[model samples]
Target chain A: MNATLVFARKEALEIVRTWRIWVLPAIILFFAITAPVLARFTPEIVGAVAGDQLGGISLPPGTYLDAYGQWIKNLSQITLFALIIIYGGIISTETSSGTAILVLTKPMSRGAFVAVKAIIHSVFLAVLTVIGTLATWGLTAAVFGHAPADPVWSSALIWLLLGVFYIALMTFFSVLIPSAVGAAGAGMGAFVLLTIGALWKPLSDHSPAGLAGQAAALAAGKPVPDLLWPVLVSLATAAVLVAAASLLFRQKEL
Target chain B: MSAAIRAAGLTKSYGRKLVLDSLDLDVEEGSIFGFLGPNGAGKTTTLRLTTGLARPTKGSIQVLGHDARAAGNAVRSAIGYLPDVPAFYEWMTAPEFLSFAGGLFGMSGSALHDRTSMLLDLAGLTDVQTKIGGYSRGMKQRLGIAQALINAPRLLLLDEPTSALDPMGRKGVLDMIASLRGRTTVFFSTHILSDVERVCDTVAILDRGRMVAQAPIDELKARYGKEKVVVEVTENADELAKEFGERPWATAIARGALGSIEITVTDLGAAQHDIPAIVAARDSGLARLEAGEIGLEEVFVELVGGGR
Candidate 1:
């Protein structure tokens, strides 16, 4: 009934009817099905490739931990890249293409437009992440004969929180940059800075960037130092980014 | 009638280039107002400013009696705007797009449904189930108007609504605007003078970002328009044109329709009296003689210095 919800429904339909529904889901699903397979057969494949180089040496057997670890690696690198690229044009494209003019000329506020986009896209990524994590959990159990759901689920959920931060960050960049390509480029640059920031102890333990290391450690069934600060910071950062995006979009000329 | 839109000292500049310069405009609440101009004459800029899509550099614009920039979305509910090249969710069908547009205005249930159906019928897209992406230029232009009317907005701002359509498409859009004459205040901008001539009751001509002329369609034509005397001779029409050019009453002369010579006159009565004498002296048979008012095109050319 709310105007924001109405516009959000239109945006959701756009994702469903356009190529957007397939691209990110397909990428995450590709990792979900193949990460476990790759984790299981990688040792054998390596041994075969080095057949004559080794003198009857055998590699260690892969485990469910390795499967989950592979999944986390793919998510942090490949899936995160896809998410940034997919959402980079979320706000910029609408304004540049003149679609925003028509909608904003109605009763809907510019802030409502940006807020709806951020909420819908973040929720979309969250849902897909959950589905992908469940798929990986089921496939990991099948490949390794046994798998713990708690560590895998917790790790994937934390990584998803970090992914939501990127979605908000991309929304902000899209508002600041009018060109979709420029927005995506700025998002990548920020990702690089965040990745570098993860190396510092305080930043890693206190910021969203730290979630990556925490996610990998959790996937390996290892104990983490502090999950509260990183989780809180990532969520807070996402909220701040979305708010800033809304503020900037209010002044944006369509 | 009260003013539907009012702008005073409205100006817009993109960096160093000034797009609009101190434009002041007023549109009556129930008139189909046409904003006529040449290409890049800042017609679209004025529309954007009035719709609150772009802010004025050094002026104020009030829409529906509210300050457009300050009120923002609060004022927009009473206004519907269509940009020059309207973009839509290409995946949405005509009805779906209209429904989406209506939903934004908080319309729903039977109200939204009926409005969507009526607009689709008006646009002649009621049965066209194809998505907007597959629509032709004309179909898209008509659908653009349909979405803008979904809320029954009091003041509709259209920026070059029919600039990119064929004759039939232009006619369809003009007829739709004409149908809204008494129901709403239509402020449509276009360089097509004939479109303004066809459907607009009042018009303002803009040249180089300034308001050159503004009045009722008839008043603007009469104030700035030249009177014409058209004469068709059986032979030597060009010679008769030359002879008419030499007269004191003829301000300008050109070739008229059907091998006739059109003489633009300072005094219609003098030109009427002298044309037959000139034709008879040239020994040319006068097949036809007609005196009439000049069209908006001639008036636009007189004021703006060129045709669209």
Candidate 2:
């Protein structure tokens, strides 16, 4: 087997055997099971809390659309935050802990090391996103009596691309910073910058910043103004980040 | 014999601080070469440079006749390296980690399985069946050596392999290295002089990022190591040591245990013949006088001027 394939297998096994299996998967599954439940019961719960003091206001009845919105919101915010934290130490920890020296001294290239990590984690995020989306869809039908698969699938795919972008982004930071905590800080700062960048029209339309909004709009069955540019630019930027990380990691002293 | 590793003017620096300065070296094929140095003496830096894990700031290194930096996987595939502190995935057992290491070298199926099994037994972890995180420091060191050998590399670079091990653990690691004699060229770096003297055929002493001395173990002891005459007296041991320090043949003298004075000498014959006369002249009862064999520790201290 090639070094990349071998290392990728080790990384996959690591994800299953370590604490890594618990954190993000737990967060994704938790949101998948709870998002539709919360969307269905919120109206009745709010009405019960303010029974006599309705103040001439009436709460709207929950529906399947509300479940999709809740699912997209959680995926974009809570789940994305967890993903950033989980991948914070991806490359940096291996080097700092001296495991890279053991493997890199073999026939493996530094580029292979970085690429294997990016690919594995991106695949992991995609798998979790697919499973979570399916869970939300199934439970939404059980709770709201109707579930639209197209809206959920399209939105989840968009969010999955955004998640892949973050994986590459975090890999770049992990290579740039030697300390895991420091790398995570840089990743969060980039996230804040991306969120702020989304406020600008050009960045919103052409970069990863646009994916979150498009995902929410898609979940509500609304037509997006544009999607191709954002998707293309996001995937390209992700490739650039991973390539840059490999270059930087090669120069890094083990 | 052909050289397994050859370097010229090799240097490394972290910013303004130089870790290894212009080191030139060679290791004959199939020889266990000991890289001896004190802490912070750049032994690890030299090993890292040779392994291609860290690039040198200047000069070049050739491992198994290939440029370490430019040869990439070609050179790497032929070399195995164990860092001073080897780290493993805490979730992995010993066999799993060894198999992972072998896989990186393109070993598979029965070959990988047999290698992992042999390494696990060599590391004494075959039946332990515990995750790496649960292992002691000594167990981890043994496992580190095992993983490094997974590729059956032509050259094995070990940095301070026994620094953190206990007596039995140290003996175990030394036994493993000795068992590899003539099979692979072992570049072992350590501050433990005894370990080098025990298993290494040749040794190099490094101090403050420079090569001080490099030679065969016995040759180094004979060339730089000073012979000592241990003299014991019934009284006035300190005064006798002071007197011995003034003699023409004595280069250095120190008070030894049991009221004895050890005199380092340029000529063992002169010291043996003259020492008794001096003790009798001082009127102290001479109890014991014997010549002490020079060890690597004394040679290392002579070259580096201090113990680790």
Candidate 3:
């Protein structure tokens, strides 16, 4: 337990020192604020730039849901990409560069090494989600004149859960592959397959990728049908991914 | 004293290529034992087996009386290993890296504090607060030693610790290793014969994945090394070489260019007694006559067969 905590602290420090703290959350926050701002001002900006081209083509007034939809869409895509970019090499780099050998020799279990990496990445994901959420909420409230707290909270939290799942999936693939780019490729490949599986009705609400797809409806206060199954499935899958990662990492040669 | 590490019929193969043949080794507790071998002589493989970082394919290993392959693998806690090229997090300061390493070994608070400080001072890295990424190779190697000693392990395994360092850096690292002579069983491998001579009490010379010799440094020299006798006479040098060659005691004799006679003697006492009498009888002025000197480099060269 102590080894795990120590390794976890090291991983957290790595994330902070490497600018993941600034880059991931800052990018997410940038999108969080800009998404709504872009949605609220699209009409005026278009009118100013291409007024003659769009002569008298009136646009609808941006509602609370429009800003909410923009936030969810931007976050679901950009934040997902950011997550992949941020943590893609978390485990693979250590293994490849021979850094893990020194640490592994010191009475630290391989399970602790992998588990701490997953846990710390999850913690960073949680922090990014909370900060992004608050920043988006404030920007949306300022633009739309009203904040739809409940649905935005639901959507952001759900997406954030999916982010944790991505961390696990990346860790699992990173162990399976030997390099950061290869690991990210493996993860993105599996992610695409999972997204495709979300289209099947039986798996649509239970697939790990289904949560991200339902974010728009989740943020619009529209009842997202069968939300419980997807959340449960995503968490269970993440747990299994982390477990598999630990097992594979234990067997890996330094 | 119990052996710090023991291996019987230990064999390891990667795919079909055998890296370590069926080999036996023993390291006694509380000795600065040098594991000497040429590169690719399975020295690293042996260290890996002892540390439980790797498993042997065809034999058993006992480290600190525990089966290293068996459950729990707690024996690793008592070991501090510095790989040939030890790398670090590259983002951590020396003290922070030590604290993190200490925590892994369940050391914390002031106990960890004092140990880290002492080790850093020992490694001579206390003043440098730069992250490990900016450290030079020597600095990193020193820090590597510090972290390895963080847990105060009973056995320290270093793989070619001086393989790639300047003389100053190697001396510093060797001095630090020397300080742990009694407290830790230092089993380090190096191809450099001088290094083993400088610090090791006992040595095991390995060749082609097989151990050629393992004994106390002096004993190994006595067993495999022949005592050399150099006689520089004003005359009758070649005649004495021929005479000594035919004698029962001289195993080999080589006459040098400068009226010098070199002889490898089986009986040092007889040769020393006989040499002066021969020089005195010949009326040859003896400038220098030195006997009973054995060079470790000769024994190492004999064991490994010429690849330094």
Candidate 4:
């Protein structure tokens, strides 16, 4: 346990000192603040651009829900890609550069090293998710007033859980693939496959990918629909993936 | 005395290629044992197996009396390993890297801080507070040595620590290893014979995954070295060589261009007695006679084959 904590702290420090700490968070924060504001006024901007094309095309009632919806859409597409770009090299860099040999030769076990990396990345991802979500919430409320669409606390919890699950999954992929490009490709491929599975009526309730989709719906005053099974399954799947990563890492020659 | 590291018939293979073939090694406590080998001779593989970084295919290894295969964690904690190319988190400064290494050994708070500072000074990086990425190859190698000693390990495994260093860097590392003579048992692998002679008291030469010879440095030199006599002659060098060769006491004789004859004899005393009579009989005038002990390099070449 002591060695695990030591490795965890070192991993955290490495992430904090990396250039990504400045660039990744800055880009995410900019999107978080500007995404909702853009959503709130995109119709007007579009109408202005359509001047003389339609003479005038006034948009319908644009509620805070619309702004939240835009926020989720932007995050689901761009923010997730940014996350991959930042975290893709987390394990591959160490392995390729031979740095893992030095660390593994220390008193720490391979299992502890893998576990600590997962925990540190998960915590960083959760914190960034909170920052992004809260910034969007503040901006949306300022532009279109707070609405009683859905329970804010539960909705925020869902987003946080989804972020943790994705981070864990990405970390697991990083361990399974030997190269950074391969790991990133595998992670994105898995994400696409899960997204497709979520569209199927029979599989949607059990697919972890539905967690993010359901949270977006909840923010738009739509029925959350029973997602307990998906939540449980997602948590179980994340655990299994992380355990597999640990086992694979343990056998790696370093 | 307990052996710091012991391996019996250690074997490892990658696919069908046998990297380490049934190798055995024993490093006693507080001895600087040099593992010398040519490239692709399995020196690094042997170090990896003994340090618990890689499992052997068909042999058992024990470090500090802990089973390396079964109790790897325990054995690893007692060993400090420096890879051929020591790598670090590029963003971390020397102090931070050492502290992190100490923490992995379960040191905390003030203890970690003290060890970190001490190691930083020991590694001669006390004034350089820059990140490791900016360090030169020599600095990285020095830091590697410091990190390996962070846990006060019972056994230190260094894989070609000076292989990539400049002259000054190699000298610095040699001095540092010499300074740790009695403090820790060091098992370093290198192809540099001079470095081994400089700091190592005991050495084992490996060739093609097999140990050709292993012993104390002086003992090996004394056992394998041959004594030779060089006699400078003023007259009849060819005739003197023929007469010396004809003698039963002279094992071998060679005539030099400068009217000199070199002779190898099993009994130096008998040859010394017979040489004067042969010189008188052959009417050869001797100018200078010299006899000296053979050097370690000659012994090494004779034992391991000089081509490498």
Provide DockQ values for all models, in the order shown: 0.81, 0.84, 0.58, 0.60
Model 2's alpha-carbon lDDT is 0.89
Off by over 4 Å in 4: A54-56, A147-153, B228-292, B306-308
Ranking by DockQ: 2, 1, 4, 3
Question: What are the per-residue Cα lDDT tens digits for candidate 4 across A9-29?
Answer: 878787788885887678768
Per-residue lDDT over B1-308 for candidate 2, one digit per residue giving the tens place of the 0 to 100 score: 99999989999999999998999999999999999988999998898888887888999998899888776888888888889999998899898888888888889999999999988888889998879999998899989989988988889999999987889878988998888899999999998888998999999888999999989998988887788888889877878888889889999887767767888888899988888888888888889989987889888887888554
For candidate 1, give the docking quality class from DockQ: high
TM-score for each of the candidates? 0.97, 0.95, 0.91, 0.88
Q: Evaluated with TM-score, which candidate comes out highest?
A: 1
Query: For residues B1-308, could you state the per-residue lDDT of candidate 1 as single tens digits?
Result: 79999999988999988998888899999999999988999998898888878889898998889988876666778888888889998999999999899988889999999999998988889899888999987788889988888988899999889877888778888888898888899999998888899999999999988889889999988898888888889888887788789989888988856787888888999888877887888888989888999999998888889553
Per-residue lDDT tens digits of candidate 2, residues A5-123?
99999999999998888888889999998989999999889888989798869888888888998999999988888878888899988988878878888889999899999999999
| Candidate order (TM-score) | 1, 2, 3, 4
Cα error of candidate 4 at position B157, Å: 1.0
Question: What do the candidate models score in CA lDDT, each in turn?
Answer: 0.89, 0.89, 0.83, 0.79
Q: Which ten contiguous residues of candidate 1 chain B have the minimum total lDDT?
A: B68-77
Interface RMSD of each candidate, angstroms, one decimal: 1.1, 0.9, 1.7, 1.6
Clashing pairs in 4: none
The better-scoring model by DockQ among 3 and 4 is 4
Q: Chain B of model 2: TM-score? A: 0.94
- Best candidate, DockQ-wise? 2
* Interface RMSD (Cα, Å) for model 3: 1.7
